[model samples]
Target: MSLEIRKIVSFEEETLIEGYKKADRPLRMFAVAAVVTNPWAGRFVHDLKPVVREYGPQLGELLTQRICELAGGAENIEAFGKAAVVGLNGEVEHASALIHTLHFGNFYREAVEAKSFLSFTNTRGPANAPISVPMMDKNDGGKRSHYLTLQFNIGDAPAADEIVVVLGGATGGRPHHRIGDRYQELQELGHDVDNPAAV
Candidate 1:
């Protein structure tokens, strides 16, 4: 089935100053959102896989393409994440159904050649709700410096019968990262940083 897309929203944010100092370079972030009709709103659906399978790839590809364009290219995306917001009439699972599938996430992952899974949030809310997209290093989940969040909202989205799916990216990590990575903390605790299983 073809997706019932209502609208697509694109956002970009750049941090040029950090901690009252000028950044050597801007830290760029991007997000692309698609507001689509919720197929199972206001009702319990025993099966979601059919819609998931049918819609995941298309949504994934469309959003990833916009992200790449906004970030200049997939290779420039150092951190990435996703989010979904279901309208009041829908379940949180309705939002998840569109984004949590491998069929949906793989497009962005493969495009950026990432090693870490895409971080995500699935929630239910009203129109114009805060859309939070949490991100981490595209290649390294333990990289504390690359943790990021993108926040934006649509004024009239997910109108009690819609879902908003989003994909987000960052050009690089924090402008001045003083804190070390997770590996350092792990090593301090006497865990084998190189061999996580041994810990």
Candidate 2:
């Protein structure tokens, strides 16, 4: 399957504080987005497995490289996530098929050296529908303070048969992270550090 990329977009945001809490340095976020033709649009395909398997890695690698570049390199990225929005003519599955695969996700994970799975959002929507990509600490998923979300939209994109794909990255977690880490919570709950269950 060939991906006909119509356009590529990048977004960057800076925050000096959140809710009266100020940080020593500004927090920065980066996201790279792609708008492309949906090969399976306007139809129902029961067997999407092969298509996803083949295309996931290709798109993943391409998007990952762009995001890493925008974030100033993979080494500087601390939190990461991905998202997809399918045009009005496509099914939600068409959006999900791109980002949910390991073939696609692992490139970003390995690049950032993050152990946690990439947080994500997938949906069907029209142009300029606020797209959001949720991020988490690359090395530790349970870090409350490291949780973040990057949101943006393209005024003229995803034209009913297209899809918008995004990859987001942060140089660091939230400033003044006082919420505490998840490993501490696990220890407090008397769960084994190696393998803990949700409480």
Candidate 3:
């Protein structure tokens, strides 16, 4: 089956830190999302593992692009912060995807080149809540899955404060057609949605 990519939920220009405070260490947070279709969901695909493995890296790249764009470009984010990736439900495995995307970082210790400086917090819950669920088997039958919400935190950065970015399916993960469809619905509802290029 064909897969659709969408921005189900997102946060834009959200200042993780209110005002600049003089401290030895400071924290910044930001949130963003890229809900991808399972491609093999509800259907049997022989190459599921490989497909997920491949798409994981692509998703990471997309997320990094969104983060950089949110920071106003590559030259803006200073290398002085920590970041986090928040998975909506099934997106927790995205951590592996991120590691794959930043594989070059092992050779070069730079966030810009890595295109990502955020760590991932693998948790399960509703996209809008802070609760979590125990890990489950990926091959369980008659089960439902949700999208992942990647969150980033920048600590002690001079150019910017704390930021939080969340990425997940707009429909909260119950086969709502495509990921971007929910985002469109939210936009039409006048929810403050931010574009990838927003600063």
Give the best candidate by TM-score. Answer: 1
Clashes of each: 0, 0, 27
Worst 10 residues of 3 by lDDT: 156-165
Tens digit of per-residue lDDT, candidate 2, span 96-177: 9989899889998888888899999998899898899999988888888879999889998778999998899888888887
52: Cα error in model 1, Å:
0.2
Alpha-carbon deviation at 179 in model 2, angstroms: 1.7
lDDT of 2: 0.88
lDDT for predicted candidate 1 compared with the true structure? 0.94
lDDT of 3 by residue, 19-97 (tens): 3434223322234454444343233334445554555455555655665566555444332122223333234343233
- How far residue 129's Cα lies from its native spot in candidate 3, in Å, is 3.2
lDDT winner between candidates 1 and 3 = 1
Task: Assess candidate 1 and give its TM-score to the true structure.
Answer: 0.97
lDDT-sorted candidate list, best first: 1, 2, 3
Two-way lDDT contest, 2 vs 3, winner: 2
lDDT of each: 0.94, 0.88, 0.34
Per-candidate TM equals 0.97, 0.91, 0.40
The TM-score, computed over Cα atoms with residue i paired to residue i, of candidate 2 is: 0.91
